[model samples]
Structure formats: structure tokens, C-alpha cells
Target: MNFTRINGLAFAFSAIKYIRYNQDFTKTTATKTTDPRPWLGLDGLVLALVCLLFLILATGDGSGNESDARLVLTTRRRRVQRRLRILSSVPSALIVFLLGLILCFIRDPTIFSDIKLGPSRFHVLKITWDDFKVGFVRGAVPQIPLSVLNSVIAVCKLSGDLFPGTELSATKVSVSVGVMNLVGCWFGAMPVCHGAGGLAGQYRFGGRSGLSVVFLGLGKLVLGLLFGNSFVRILSSFPVGILGVLLLFAGIELAMASRDMNSKEESFVMLVCAAVSLTGSSAALGFGCGIVLYLVLKLREMDFSGFPFFRSKSEPTAEDESLINP
Candidate 1:
């Protein structure tokens, strides 16, 4: 099949994998569905929705404060246009998108289900709201206009002084990687969250996908050295529709890869999570849903002892024991 067709099919499957199931399954069922290959469509849909939401918010006409932002954007139209011009290029998207693609493909322990389909290792991290210290101290208070840019510049200068040589260390590599990841995550930058994907996928790390992420890092390094700002400027110009297409495909591939959550309960939960994520932020939605689910099960008089993540459910199992609610 053509790549587009494959992408669409994958997205559909992923949605199936991620949606809310509204019920639980027998232990046998969960085991039977753990392969994780059928959920690609869901991932594609989720990411596509994320990008689309951002584009709608950025481009849509809004109230006074927003109009003022647009006015500022228009006042700087040439600069924005210049940026858009560069972003529209194929190579730029390839370079940027490739960063994400490589991460998806090369991450350790495989974030997706199919071992043959992506990196040898994959990981999924759950960030709870309670994990934060919930305090603002010193110069760190959520965005205050141009302070972020200044801070970044300060770091850049410090980095140069700290290294003071042509050589790169693990720390330097991590610093550069982190900066790229942040840039990609914000202001239309992508391919920055390499973390487990790059590290686990690399040589002797039991990674099959390491080569892909390595190439991406290397590509960025080359761009930094050879093309530099001009190359970056060009990459910044890609259209929303094009990125939508890419995100759509990427999400599908990822969701399809997460086929292990195949129980009716898991699938339903995924759908609910995706919808919530699409409508709101994923973290908020995930946490809210988790709380509700916990409560609902408790209300139904289901013993917390049998449920996953409960204090009672984690004891070492005997050979005769199975993952049942009984």
C-alpha cells in the first residue's frame, strides 16, 4: 500500500486501541490482546488533534488581547513571512520531523508494542500532578514576556564559556539535545524529546532503532555546523496543513504500535483519554480520568486489593495465581 493509505489505516487501529472501553475484561482477554500492534490509528489521531488544536488557536481570530497579539504578528509580518518561507521547505520538515520519527523508532524498551516495528526498547512515562513542589522561587515564574529568550541566551553564553574547547561531552550532548527538544516542542519546533529513544536505541544498548535517532542527531549536528541559521530559518517555514499531515501519520504509527492495551477496558480508557486529551491537556485529562476511575471502582464495591496500582494488588504471585479480579 501507499504510505498515506498505510498511515490512515494505522490511525484507525490506534483509535481502537486508545478509546474508552467502559468495562473490564477477564485475565485471559488481557493476555490475548497484549501484542500492541493494532493501536496506531489512535496515536495518529491524538497527535493530529494536538497540532490542529494549536493551529486553530494561533490562527483563529479572537477577542481584544488576541487581536492585539495578531496585530503584533502582522506588524512583524515580514519576519514571520520570512520564517514561514523557510519552514515550508521539505528538507526542514524532514530534518525536524525526523527527530521525532527517530525517537519513536529508536527508543529503548519500545514505547510501541511491535518489537519488529520500532526501537528494541520502549517506554511510557506517567507524570502525576502531585510530583511538583508547587512553589515559585527566584527568577522562575511562568513566562514573563521576553525573559525566556534572555535566559536561553544566558545559557548559551555560559555553555560556550563552560566548554571552551572544540570537543563535546555527554553533558554538552545532553544540553544541546535538550535545547533542540524544547525548541521543537515550542514555537512550532519538533523532534526534541529524544530521551529514552536515543539512549536506548543506540549501539549495544539492545536497540534496533538506534541508527535512526543517531542519524537524526547527526543531521542536526551537520545543520548546526554547515547550514546553521539559514537552514533553521528554512525549516521554520513549513505549513500547518503539511505538519498536520505529518502529525496525523506519526500519531497513527505510534498508536498502532501500542497494541498491548487491547482489553475492552484498556481500549475504552484510551479513547476517553484521547478525547479528553484532544479537548483538554493530556496530563489533566489522564489524572482526572484516573481519579474518576479509581472512585468508580470503589463505589462499585470492587476490592482495591484486586485492582492494578492498589496497595493490595502488588504482592508476589504464586504459579497458580492469575491476574484475575477474584
Candidate 2:
């Protein structure tokens, strides 16, 4: 099929994937429809709708072009935009989360009665050498390339786009990721990376500087120290449908990164890459396909008409050029 047709199909596939992921919260088991898990029930639908409504109300017009903060022509408008940015930066997602907790309590007054407060078990030296070896060989090896692509290269590109004069070097990002993961492994913390999607989400929500990340890190540390595993109880009772709505918005914000693909070829490749990554559940495979297609399209632009074999008799060939010159 032509690339254009392929691109359209790719977009459709991506859209379907996104919809299904969010819709799953509202759907029950296909194997046993008789099971009552709040799927498609009044509670699930109501929770989702209420959360959606609150999220929409909380995010009216957003922080107003945070990327263009320095380009504002008038002082009055700049002041207004700055105020909006500060207000919008209040973490509306957290507000929605708390609202969900309140709704959960209203529905089931004894939801948190079973939660026992205590210090969570520390995860120091939890992994053995053999387990590390196996996991590193099987999982880490395959994920390295994807991490480089998304965590370093894509992040650098997106940061440049979001903060025009900012310079977030790939080298620094790679080192930071490596160091963080190395230290985290000792404490059995989940491996972490600076993903482009996360950066985009931060930018979408009025996070303009490193200070925002610092604040976030501090907040997380404080929460971990204070609540520990006990907080999991509150998180567990939170409505899945509301979480789906939150993720749906995050996905949409991340998808906006593709808006920079202005050319038809780039857009086609991006869509195909995304579709493959989503449908196949392998970013590496999608990266390989995108690279191959990009090279092929680029090669197609070469002028074979200049070759002697491709020229008609009316056009001077390489041999005929010598004859004419003489």
C-alpha cells in the first residue's frame, strides 16, 4: 500500500488503541458478563463523568502559551498570563484525585476502615545477582535502545521546542538516567528515565523551569516519608474510570508532540511508528520500521535521470558529452 493510505490506517489504529485503553475501565470481563465489577455500571459511569467534568472545569484555557512567555508584547497581558500560569500550576490532577477520594467515601463510608497504618517494608538489597543477570539480559538489553531514543534524544528535541533557548544535552540526560537507575537499584526502586511524554505533560501543565521538578520531587519524598504503604489504601479505592480520564488527557497532551511533523513524509512515518509501537507493543520494532521507511523515502529523491543508462538519445549521455566537447 501507498504511504498515505498506510498513514491513515496507522492513525486509526492508534486512535482505537487509546480509546480501548480508556474504555476498558468501563467494560467488564468478556468471559463472564455476569460478574459485577462496577464495569459499565452506574457507579463507574458516574465517577468517570464527574471526574471528567471537574477536570474540564479545572483546566479552562490552560496556562496560556507557556512556551511563549518571553514573547509577550504588552505588560498587562504578560502579568495576566503569569498569574494564570501560577494558578494552573497547582496540580489539578491532585485536586481531581482528592475529589475522587471524597466521592469514594460518600459511596462507601467504611472504605478506609481496613487500612492499617505502619511503616512500609524497606526494599534494600531485595534482588539477587542471578535475578539481576536474568532480568538485565532479557529485559534491560531489549529496552536500552528505546530508552536512548525516548529518554535522551526525544527528550532533548522536545525540551528545545518547549524552551526555545534551553539546552538539555543528551549526554547529561543519559548520564542522569544511568546514575539514577544505578542508585535506585540498590534500594529496589523502579528504574526511571526522563521520558519525552513526561516533559510534554509538565509543559502542558505550566511547568516552565527545573524548580517545578524540584518541588515535585520534594512533595513525593514528603508523601513517601509520611504515608508510606498506608497511602496505597486510599489509592486502591480510587475510581479506575477517573484514573482512565486522567490518563486519556495525558495521552492527548503527549500526542501533541507530533504537531511538529509538518511534512507529509514525516507525518506518515510518525503515525506509522506510533501505530506500530501501540499495536505491536514494541517501540524498538516501530523505531526500526520508521528508520527503514525514512531512508527509503530519502533514497527515492535521488536523480536517476542523470545516469547514462536512464537518459534518452535526445539528452546527451556521459559518452556523448566528451564527443560534444571535442
Candidate 3:
């Protein structure tokens, strides 16, 4: 499968950062808020247990070789593969989500007290010059490069890798993301962007075509229409352990995409980027570093056989390699 090693690492780091945000150990307590404490906690252990159960369920079919095109399957084998595919199409996340709701209901029914169906809350236009300046500096400035790399570039690249014939352009994705935020912000929605991790997760879960996204959009629309603020209770009460399991699998699946790097230099670049992203908590920094490292490598490999300006035009280049292999 065609993949970018750096993109895979970015997905994994993003997942880890998201998972950490949800875990109890990462919470802001009165005293522990400022301290960098260990990540081990009761919730972490519970999450691990839930993850193990889900992992078993996910791999129970033991059909890892489904992607091995070299193997010619018998009719019976094909039947089994078809059956597994059908079963996999049934979203396991729904089951986990419902289970979490049930558990919450049983443990404390008061959590459902806020489940009154109604319209969603919307924000009135209240932007001031100061707010805009502060938001631009604190939020937009840092997010620009990250969004460009992860949302536009990474997503477009992954879409091509996952769907060979499908060609997604960064410009299209960028425009889509911008339009989405412009409309969504008025409805009090969080700023959103298309992400490589999200694309990888969808593909891992058997969402192969545009129809899958259409169905998902329809489902969300229905839910919003019917429940509105009521759904917030379900989300708030949902089991963190189960959520952790979902994120854990997503991160692993995304990380596995890096396996196709196949070259030491590519792997080295990816690892350096991932490490910096994780440690510095800045995707922009990692991306900048990766670009610099890639350029350095290319410079080292430049043909010095001729004078700098007289290099052979026929020499193989990285772009040519990617085009041939991709």
C-alpha cells in the first residue's frame, strides 16, 4: 500500500495527544495541575483492560492475510472472508457506545436527567477587534502550519494511498475545511479539520467509498435533529475506558501505516518528526524539522559528479521514485 512514513507518525502522535486529553491522569486537579506526573492511574488501567477485550474481539476472526494478494483462496475461504467482511461492516463502536450508556444509566440514572430533546444552542455574532487579534495570535497562528500539513496535505496524500484511483487535491481539502469552520462556528461548533488519522480510521473500519461519509453525515443530522443538547449527556457519560480503547486502536492502525516506509532514511525522518512532535507538543515544529531533514538528505545525495549547475538531467530523483513506486 502507498503511504508516507511521516504522515503515519503524525497520525500516531495526534492520536496519543487526543487520548491523553481524555485520560484521568491528564486531568487538572487542584494540586497536580502544574506538575508533570506519571501517566499511570486507575482509569489508565481500566482503559487497558477494556482495550484488551476489544482487541480480542477485533482480531477474533484471525483473517490477517485478507490483504495478501499473492494467495489464491479456495471457495470456502472466500466464503469466510465474505462473511467476515459483512460482520466487520457492522460498527463495533456503536455497540461500545451503547454499552457505556447502559452502564452509566445503571450506575447513576441522574446522568440521563439532562436528556431532554431540543434544538441546539447557537452563538450570536459577538466578535470584537481585540478578540480577533488575540484569537489570531494564540490559536490561528500556531494552527496554520499544523492544519496545512495534517489536514490538507496529509489527508490528500492518504486519500490517494488508500483509494488508488481517487485524486484529492490539497486546495480542495483546504477550501472544504475553511468553509466548514466558517459555517460551523456560528452554530457554536468547535473548529474542525480533515485529518489523516480520521481518514485512516475510516478506512480501517471498512468505510471505503463516499457513500460511507454520506451515511455518517445523515446519521449525525438525524441525531442532531432529534436529540440536540440531550445527546451531550450520552457523550459526557460515555465510558472513558471504552473511548480509550477506540483511540488506542486508531493510533495503532495509523502507526501501522508507517510500515510501508521501507527505507532507512524515510524511517529516520519520520521518527525524528514524531519524537519532536510528541516532546514539544507542536506539529508545526515537527513538520518544519522534517522538511529541513529531507532537504539535507537530498542535498547530501546531490550529484557532485558534474559542476553544481551541470548535473545530469536523467538522474533519478525522489519525485521519480515516488511516481514509479506509488
Task: State each model's C-alpha RMSD to the native.
Answer: 24.4, 6.6, 8.0
Instruction: List model 2 lDDT by residue over 64-142, tens digit each.
Output: 5355645745888878767766666567777776777776666666756855555567867878889989989987998
Clashes of 2: 0
Instruction: Tell me the deviation in Å of residue 36 in model 3.
Output: 14
Instruction: Encode model 3's per-residue lDDT on 1-326: one tens digit a residue.
Output: 22244555544554444345453444555222222223455334455466547654654432342546788989998998787666565666666666766766765688667677766776676778997799789988888987887788767777776667685987889999999988876666778999777777666666778898899889888988888878877676565555655665555555565435778998788778877776745767777788899899999998786785676668789998999999
In order of lDDT, best first, we have 3, 2, 1
Candidate 2 global TM-score: 0.72
Count of steric clashes across candidates, in order: 53, 0, 0
Q: Per-residue alpha-carbon lDDT of model 1 for 77-187, expressed as tens digits?
A: 767655544433224334435544443444332323322222223234443444223422322244221122222322233223322452224455556755775454333
lDDT of each: 0.38, 0.66, 0.67
Best lDDT among the predictions, by candidate number: 3
For model 1, what is the alpha-carbon lDDT of residue 207?
Answer: 24
lDDT for residue 164 in candidate 2, whole number 0-100: 77
Quote the lDDT for 315 in model 3: 78
lDDT of 3: 0.67
